[model samples]
Target chain A: MSTRTELHYAFALAALCALDVAAADAPVAPAHPLDAPAALKAAFAERIGHPVNVLSFGFGEHYAQALVQNAAAPDEFDEYEAVPGRPLEPGRPKKAGEVDCRKKIAFAALDLDAGARALAQARAAAAANGYKTPDNVTLGADVFCNDFGWRAILTSDANDDAMLQIVWAPDGTSPKAQELHDGGWRKVDVAKLLAGSAKVAPAAPKAEPKTVAGDGRKRDFRRGIDADLARLEAEVGAPLGFKHIGIDRTQLSVDVFQSANRKRVSTWLVGDDGAIKLWREDDTIPFDCNKPFAAGDFPLAQLPDLVADAPSRIPPMPQAQVKDVAVYRSGLCGRPHVYIKLEDERGYGNVEYDERGRLVSAQIQ
Target chain B: MAKTAVAKILLALGASLMLAGAVAGAEAPGTDYGWPNLTDFLKQLIAKVGAPVKVYKLAMDRDGKVDLWIQDQAHPDLVDSWEYDHGAIEGPIPVKFDHYPSIAALDHHVIELTTIDFPRLPAMLATARTKLGQPDARVVFIELERGDSSGFISVTDTPIWTIALDSPRHDGRVEFDLQGRVLDVDKD
Candidate 1:
């Protein structure tokens, strides 16, 4: 063969090799940590200072399969079935023998020393509440806005005894209060009750005369005179008008204010055509006809520009992001659903879309 | 003419045979030279080095990238090991396997150590030394066979302090100094 022919063959071989190398270097999805090297186990143990086991709890069955691939002896790792439990529903009572009670939500157990330190901290918190633990007293009931914190419910057979339950904020701020439920646990608006109790007493009322002596004929004549006056006013097309009836302006104003307060704030405008229109505001309060009309409801044209710009006047589209992406299969549902978690600063905001990609009711998870 | 052509061929063949012999002689242990498995090798090394230098547990470092350990006679229970890849360490240092064959000859345990950054070994060793004190150290290099008909080699060097490996095969020829603490390893 000529030198040129040899060079051509060589160039073709080189091109093929380059393509092969590029194909080999292309990035595939990364394997889960279990399929990782035995070295990873050692690193985890060192970091956590305990025997660390990475387990899959929820709907991801593929994770277990991935882990088997990297096992040193092929299936040497221990596998345990997660206990079946009901999905958490807001305001529902926790059932007896629920698997969720046994589920280990914490990443890892604290070492002995760390556990001791935590216990000491808890003791210090308990002492600061002006009540000792294992004490007996009837806790005064009150309601306060717990809005975003954990409140514990402590119960004991001793009817008058009370324990301090610590309410903790996510940012580590915690306050302890004595438990107060007597028969059944009830949630009360403590702030409102305390405000009502702080009001001062009112003054006494005056007595009125029981009777007056009058001739029956004079009474009948006076009544006839009143009826004649009313007839004369009706003929003239005008009724008698009061001059100084000692009107209570304060009470009248208060009645108007109360009626306005009962009214539901205007939310988004639903067109007469029955289509829900998108608004530009952050929040929308739905309009209810049962509520008394308030200042919130002026004609859209009469509203101030700022108020009109707000979400109640014009509802804004929900803002969301993909917080976590998990793939799950439902035999009955038939199709795989990609659960794209969207969350703001709130713990777990509403999941807006359903399996069919349509807007559905928001569920707080 | 036939005799001359034959002689020319003979001379060429002779030169080639001699070159092959020279290359074989220069081959590193665990390559051309044979070494046993890592577990057996470690046992033999500990026996040769003598007691008080104990080998306890072993672990791969973060992400299986490196192997590191600490060995102290005072605390036989505690051992530290760190492993790193070529990217994690500075510079390219070829794994030397001469010291490994002798260590392996003592026992039959084999551990595959892939090519790693030499500088990372020292950094990890420094940390272990601070925790476990200085000890004699030795590195065992092994060649791993891949499924693709290609082979990649790695080394696992143990910093063993005060312990000495005495054997007729080694003849005290292999040794390394870690910050003035010298570990005399058997190269043979």
Candidate 2:
């Protein structure tokens, strides 16, 4: 067996022995899962001195090889390989016919946060197994690379209590390998990617989690939501429409979509005090929903005027209260109209009108 | 005739004294117009009940009445709340209290109203008013609570005072520390 396999074997044996001790103590919280493929691709890109899109990676008993294309200069394909204890180095050029670089890759770009979680878990796992973790390797690193792009071993349970056997199968035949192969790859900045991942990595899971604000109670996440949105709008321009608002105890963020197409335009991270702490423009197509809203059609200031006679016009329910009002386009690439919602004892109703205050549609249910 | 003139002088002095008393009442630290402000209400209640085990929250509604939630000193597990409107105190009513491990471990929410400096409230409100730049801006609500933006959590023992205003932009919530230091001011 190779030295790398022997090292993994020792770790497996140590983890098995430590399992009883771990069980005796309070149960450790589950580690965040890591993205093995993304880390491998990042490490590979760093070694090759170019951002690369990895197509397929194959491992043998002695060595590992990856077929990749330069992300910057398309059509410039290369193959890299590494043996145990050595970093990846260019093995055969794609033009030499020795390496077959396919255009298709199975996975997308990696979520760097997952990578950070992986790193943390790996470090914990190493400490648990009584091994001195290397500084260069990430915590809970699912994939281990040699000095360069020469060799790597991918394992699913590297950080698990009883370390699973490091699968050294050939030609990516394993089910896990196949799944990774089918997932295409994308280019990324390894340093920034790792740093961002590290920032979001949760503190090593404790036997007892630390108490955060709003513990043991259902917190009103929207306590200052309006103030936060207003602050965000003051900083960035008004959003076309809200695509998503993620509110939890630890974090709050709003995904804003702009333009008539309603493509996601930006994201705003909100602080506890309802301030826009950070504003990040949409770097990727996170959402593609075609629902469009004309944010400019009717400002909130116009709602009072538009719904002046709304209660009188909708006679099905008396003493109806205005609940919500929004501007929505009829169809993709259609004109914007105001939709006012009213609620009473029976049910809710919607009253629609154009910007010119012309009644368009009214439905009660 | 000379004795009558002396009597008229005495009457004029008495009227002047009454006017001075009225001016003093108007300028009282927490008196806003003819109504008792939030600080005055809190001071009266705290005097009657003593320092609470913990103060959960306090808020003023549109009617200018104040509602307070405090952990009952007699029963640590229970929360006793009250509503104050127009010089009337209407409760020692039990309220929803969620047991929290953090709060139980450390009584971080306990507040000694007697020790708290409440006189600086007017200045703080004035600062917020100047920042808002709205001539008609008025304090719609005020609260002393844990967690600056969210609901309960043992974030700090130093209680926070949030004053919300009904402004044209609707961005008029101001936060101040117990000592009246401005913590945050939402943009107008």
Candidate 3:
């Protein structure tokens, strides 16, 4: 080997040996003692019905300490120190102070098994170099965000060599996070981990509400009264006045004046469900208008055509002169119809046509 | 070639150590020289099972154990998986449909596992290490599909090899293609 390459390999092997020493420092018993803290977390999550933040976990030869915070109530937490195969020591609920929940440990992303194996690789490399691993060496991982929003730090305390320090940032593409990645720090796949676990996935972006306009364009309907009034003009010939009624403001009433007499010619009642009804003055018998016509009660753009063809659809109501014409939806039958008022010096006669302007019925009173 | 020989030597060393039970059940045993051994295992696998019609996924865990999922031609809905650990192979284990995610176009996106250039894997891994740092956990190879904004369209022809780094960088992954070309670097 060249001098530089040998030095590089030698340094790497030495670092690996130190990492191995760190892995061995943890209490040996339950096959994987480092997993004991995560097991406690899993058990606690099972009890709470969801995963919560683990503020800190301290390892010992026989017992591990964990301080966990409630996910719902972040300020509340409990601290427990427990041994393997034994119940957690009882802990009282405590309040969080000066605790940034954002930096809480991500237990799902913490794989101590991998950390130990990496250390073992380091040990093997050291063995190949014929170096004796120091007995007093210690290695550990601190899996929590430090200053950055990304959680988890897989760092070793072996002679300042940050071997295999992995950090998981939500936005892995961030420059700082990427810098950490370039600096020998591995990034955890939090999305994939959460997918395999019971953790709730991140909220999806809100979808835009779909809208249909008379012009076949996605026009915003919430653009104040002028736009709404303009939309209503397509149904009624220039509404003179508009007002919302009913206890819950679920009804809308509009007055239309097409003639130059300055008198209201037609009154239209629209239900919140998009049902429409029309009323005119000097009517003899009240029409059956209980059921309101809702959405799919014919398009508003077709109203002008229906009104214009109403006269030709029926014969004059028994030689009666046409007094006034009004268009409305027969809410009781859920159909749009045009009502033509007629007068023959007696009282008033009426003729009605469907949305297609086909004559349907006639009545005299 | 010298580096490859060194990797082979390390593989032998790891194998002997594993056989001695010194590093058995260790997550990603012999990670320092795991890539060459994995490629060697895959080459042997193709020789044993022949070329697969569709390769669902190939994954190596922290324990240096490899799992390969290939579609069964006779039963199109079932997938046959083979696991390799410590120089021993286990199973053509049949996995039912829906147990794992399915590709949108399985027939069109066939990964010719047999014809893959196994010799280039070590170099590709070295490039990944240089560009994106070492992987602390596992390596995964799967075909990725592009999902449409409407959630109704599927485009599943992209194949990628992901080198997942250890904790904290759990999201960090260095991506490459079958021909050992670097596709993406880190946490993609």
Candidate 4:
């Protein structure tokens, strides 16, 4: 390897702290060590000896499925269902003699390339020490985000008691305190765990609060409102008509007046810190009275006609077809318009319908 | 990544280690690499990983063996490991695992074992919202994972779901169960 690559690898390797603990540094054992729920964490930290990204730290069976496109073939996506052997879906009935109890599972995401190397290293090490690698894991990046390098997860039971029949932790227990524990709910004890325990998992990364120190914060907001408005005005110009302003302890909202009277207008939440949260001038509040309707409100049968009838040139499309239509009532504009997500400047446009099947307000987005 | 860590490293490697008066328990470890304990070594390691956050729990088991995982700030699982055995904190090489247990691997039980699927995501979210009065928190991401329920002790593979959300009112991630029950609320 080149000196540069060797130095980089050395630096990366040094980044790793420590693995197995030595006998000399062992802390004085508790006079009486009990197998409490906390034992799971202690053992995991002991085995891994690294700061594992605990995904979740509670109990309940959970899973999901999403489509991830093959990088080689961008158009081809594969849908993988990470399901339980016999999962209990929503609204499904529990069966007799069912062993479905709340168990903790911690998982991590690995950088595809790094993961491959790590896996190879692990396999070599495991083989040297009598362990085998599993088969058929390509280690592809997830759909949500691929920039992440790697992730590690583990699970442990919160139950301190060691009764096999006890599916859930005791009601008043500090560790596995569930809302309500009923029959068929089981909690595992750490003593019974094999190498990979089957009881508890770590929690996800904690999210950032809106206010760092109560100075009014939000997600994706811009630096300030005046600057944002100026930028929007520069882009949309005369059409940038916002006429209403509302303020709360945390947020300062502003919107456009549908009618000159300003009675009916859609609301936009500019960050209380005076930042613009979104580039759009509209409110994305799922179901606002201002935006009474959405893409889902319309009938399925009308989708084809709506797509075909949507004016192609009114929005002034350079070239491209409408891939999807999101219909919503623009309370600020005082009209029901369809937001079109296009395939290219002609790519996307919002078309407001006029009487007699004519296009009233069609603008490129 | 953290200035304090770099200072600690540089100070440890300098001539005449003289931090006995600066901070209580600042006496460096008797070992060659320095640092009084595993915790200090971890502080430096955390900085190297581009995360300067507090490093909690550099624990050793009863067998005189300590182990742990340190991913970058992002949750990608590029994992590396080092073992300090019987107070051999200063020497011996470390092990860098190319792969540890991902969600899928944990479910499959090659590297480790756990319940197949821990907590169903959407269902718990619906419950958490109702219990929380359905606050207008912008949900950045909702992840269903199986983690150790009680981390004070051993690691048990249990089911749990974390809903990372933010709102003008407040911001934090709420962890819940499949029945839509709130387990804990971690304010970020």
Candidate 5:
């Protein structure tokens, strides 16, 4: 077996052994399923038939109730659950096997300042389990579960009736109930049935390597930047446009504009006092700035007036009360100007007013 | 996404301009202000925000007006206003927080940034790392503010120290008060 596969298998075996010990040590209980997360992940993967990413989950609740509904085909259906953590729900103590399927749950992040601590905890748990979660997030939680980003949910206090009903909106208040037509669910295989179909378990990958800031060394910042730029040019075989640089006793880093239009870019860094070799990756920007600077649509004195109501507000989202528009004090498309963008639930676009506050141009996508 | 100290300082410098405007009785909006005087105020503002990071106020030379916030200062590593403006400056509008798009150089290459209290950075970072119980974590960036640019600043002259830390587990940003107590921690 390859090193990576062997490493993963060894981990799986060790986890299974740990679960066995925990279960055996308890006089009259099943194992304290430390491997429960892995099992659940494998099971979801089997059902999805794709390399399903077990994104994130809630905690605190002792169990998860998986419900299969709207089976388009015998195999094609939807899964939903309700997850609650501590303090949010008066959860009953687990009775060993009682912590099986038929309950949807998650842990609680009781951060004192977590405006949506429970949701944060759930997302964190998912992150820990190797799924994707957004950095900018919001949750509208009431006494029970509110409509999250799902078609349905599972749980007793869940505002939706499908984890019984789905509000299809963040506003899950007074949702139309999905009556348990065929006795909803009583037989959920949960983690046990997927034992055979489960494959390699995936855990959260470690963060990419990066350099730490410096420890107060005395050196020529400009020389270091120049050297690095020369090195980059040598490696890439092109003249790199210098965009930005920061040098101090702690570290030296630089960004380069890689395109003639000036939208393409890359970054280079020398960390650990140049102990680590620098790395580079190129990228591009969308607002094309190939054209020469011209007199824009507005004058300098009325610059603020242009942004006060420029048509750049895109993708406006009133659902989570996320303001859709934002003004920028930066340039775009290789031009120096104040740029703005508008956004909502639909789409977004960009607008650039020249440094003097004249209308340069705008593009929406 | 935090406001730069220089921007705040330039705004504070406006206080003096306001007083001068009042004294000269030239505060009226319609008064057509011309060069030398018009040009001097812009120069002072450029100084207020510090140099090499010029605020491109566009072409308001035709009008007696000004609007600038150090927009074109080449911010190292971070595309200036990347997080704050939601990527409207570089790529498409409303870029994702999770999306740290690879950047290549374009119009700017190196930006000269003026700092205050930079000498104390090492000690402050050490304090923050120890307090955070992240001994292995590294300080990726820092922002140290002592006083505003309008000159003497406040009566107490409180300094703000914000430190950014990157570790294998997660990224953390913290602010320290004058007494070195942690003000807040941002989990990324």
Candidate 6:
């Protein structure tokens, strides 16, 4: 190619490069801050009759995480402020006092006295609307603000919303307290803001066993023996007879101790099958006399059937009135258990079970 | 050839520098609102209960509210429990008593009673044991109160039952047998 042609090409390329450089250096317009305080104040005035001054503002992330890390840390009020001349540089650190008056916005504030009032109003509003707050309230010192400055956040009884935050900081200019003023304050849907602040209800108390009225005068001495015998027959799938010598009803639990102490035979008639049937020692099934009773030879499933057919009379098992199922746990085997106490005119019994299947033992009260 | 390689390396280096500059320019610092501080609440509860209490469980409900279960050395069965949101007590504070089941199907036997008034610890304990057929079991009482946001007064301790007072008040007590039976329940 000719030198003149090469020169023309180079000039065109140089012009293109210059244009790209200029475009790269051009500045873009900055975005508007959220201006949370102004928006909130306006919202509060509009929603509530009175204009509110935000005593403080809590950035949820900062407050929640900080509390988890150091439940004792002082309240923080430092926030990001857009520097007037240097938009491209890191913003300046504005203290809570400075931010209260800063022009470049998107910040939120918590009202001290006004905040408390607003919270009271909000809680009343919530209660009327069927929303329940937690029962416990916790507050800390206003470290960020001095005596003239109030520093506190009102969480629901459950500490959910941090619903109301109050910061009474020194007027920066005055020593005496001024009539509580509403800075750029905003009204928040406390329930909405505290959506995650529901107190966990305590696990429902266990139900007491129900006592049934029976013949209080004459006691059935054979009831315990009968329970034991029926339990044995059901396990063995046959009848096992034994002479009932005596019964001990004086103790809290009525037990019929049999004469099997002398009999070393593995075929000994275990009087009340209920004990063996419900016994879960190392997942071993009790001996079934119906199937030719043997030590640890019966299937676990048969125990329920045996206990069901037992002639012994037992009181109804107590049922638990569980208001919250989320924390329910069965007392047996440390598993989640739910007991429905069945009661009729005749008597009552406890039907115990869990999310899985039937447990090894169902005691008849 | 050496000159050409050097020129090529310089071009690659220039391109990488431009890319790095562009990436750095796009990054921005984000703001974060920290978590709340609950030390004051715990401390208040310790002071109010007038006993040494340990937090056994801390749970948040579906709505993000927090519930604390604290056990006092005096009353292990009776847990001083409370729930709170931001800085306010959401509801009434009450004492909880534990109960156990008598039947074998129930496991880890425990029953709870809640009352507004403080009751005699011994009476509550005795009633629970007798109902559950566990007379010789140990009993515990838990007391709780709602304080200003500064802190909470959740007192838990074994009642000495050394002093006898004549008054009708609400209180809660829990009874658990050695075998984990929750036999009786009495609550105001």
| Highest-TM-score candidate | 3
Ranking by lDDT: 2, 3, 5, 4, 6, 1
TM-score chain B for all models.
Answer: 0.18, 0.67, 0.60, 0.32, 0.31, 0.29
Instruction: List, for all models, the DockQ compared with the true complex.
Output: 0.01, 0.01, 0.01, 0.01, 0.02, 0.01
Model 5 chain B: which ten-residue window has the lowest total lDDT? B83-92
TM-score, per-candidate, Cα-based: 0.15, 0.28, 0.29, 0.19, 0.22, 0.18
Pitting candidate 2 against candidate 3, the one with the higher lDDT is 2
Order the candidate numbers by TM-score, best to worst.
3, 2, 5, 4, 6, 1
Assess the local accuracy of residue B105 in candidate 1 as a C-alpha lDDT between 0 and 100: 24
How high is the lDDT of residue B185 in model 4?
Answer: 72
Please report how far candidate 3 places residue A60 from its true position, in Å: 19
TM-score: model 3, chain A? 0.25
| lDDT tens per residue, model 5, B23-86 | 2313223222221132244334444435454221111122223222233334422322211111
CA lDDT scores, all candidates in order: 0.27, 0.49, 0.45, 0.35, 0.37, 0.31
What is the lDDT, from 0 to 100, of the residue A316 in candidate 5?
A: 27
For B1-188, candidate 6 gives per-residue lDDT tens digits of 25455444334334433332232213122201111223333333433553333443444332324466554345343344566564443322433322222222111111211211112322333445445334433322222222111121123221111111111122223433323334334432
A35-151, model 5: which lDDT tens digit per residue?
A: 233443333333334221111232222433232312232222233232322111212222222222222222121111222333343334334333333222222232234433223
Better of 1 and 2 by lDDT: 2
List candidate 1 segments past 4 Å from native: A1-155, A158-330, A333-365, B1-112, B117-122, B125-188
> How does model 4 fare in lDDT?
0.35
In candidate 2, what are the lDDT values of residues A49-126, reduced to their tens digit? 656665555433244456666677554567665444344443455631222324333224423343334334334443
Candidate 6 chain A worst ten-residue window by lDDT = A61-70
User: Per-residue alpha-carbon lDDT of model 1 for B1-188, expressed as tens digits?
Assistant: 25455444334334433332333223253222211223322223333333333222222221223232323234332222323342242211222222212222212222222121222323333333333222332223311211111112224233222222222112122222323333433321
Model 1, docking class: incorrect
Where does model 3 exceed 4 Å of error? A1-365, B1-33, B36-48, B51-53, B99-104, B133-156, B167-171
- Candidate 1 structure quality by residue, lDDT tens digits, A193-278: 22332111122343442222222222211011223223323332433221101111111000111212333221222222222221
